[model samples]
Target: MSLNIYHEARSEPQIGQLAVAHVTLNRASQSKQTVEQVVTAPKQFSWTFLQKSYVPKETDIFVDCIQTAMKAMTSKDFTKGATFYHRHDVRPKWAQSKTYVAKYGEHLFYRN
Candidate 1:
């Protein structure tokens, strides 16, 4: 989940990392899924905690950004209720039925 956020929205301005964080948190709230489940749900994100090849890198900047975003969300939720997002360069079939929320950087966010 955090990897997807770091890769997908980390490059976008407007504190896009917060939007990424919000997606996970919002999904957890609406679906009663733990943060892990929401992130690992089939086809939700490209990278997950289970991949054998995955390595946990501690990038100080990435951690800092995500930490800031998480802190910002404690008082008020952002993301415009976005529970889903996809790269702006591609349009997946799942998006056809979801409500468009907003685009952070390279990601276009959506929700039911």
Candidate 2:
């Protein structure tokens, strides 16, 4: 899960990463999908889909950043109540119907 955050959040801000982490955790608990399933569900966060060869190494900063992000996640929080998110550059048909919740960095978070 941390690896997912490290890869997906590296290009985003701390807040963006925090949001992604929280959303992933929320989906993991509420939905039957595992962390990988939640993150890589079709066109969601596409790092895994784009680069299958990518692997996150355990650097001190990576560990610390993910830890902080994970620590900030509460059951009450889900990226400002978003269960879904995607990059601002791409507009998936799925997002057109969902209510926009918040935007952090290059990503736009949404809820069903």
TM-score for all models, in order of appearance: 0.77, 0.76
Residue ranges of candidate 1 with Cα displaced over 4 Å: 1-4, 49-54
Q: What are the candidates' C-alpha RMSDs?
A: 2.7, 2.7
53 Cα displacement, candidate 2 (Å): 3.1
Each candidate: what lDDT? 0.72, 0.74
How does candidate 2 fare on TM-score?
0.76
Candidate 1 on 24-60: residue-level lDDT in tens?
8888889998877887788666665345333336586
In candidate 1, position 5 carries an lDDT of 61
Q: Name the top lDDT candidate.
A: 2
Candidate 1 least-lDDT 10 residues:
49-58
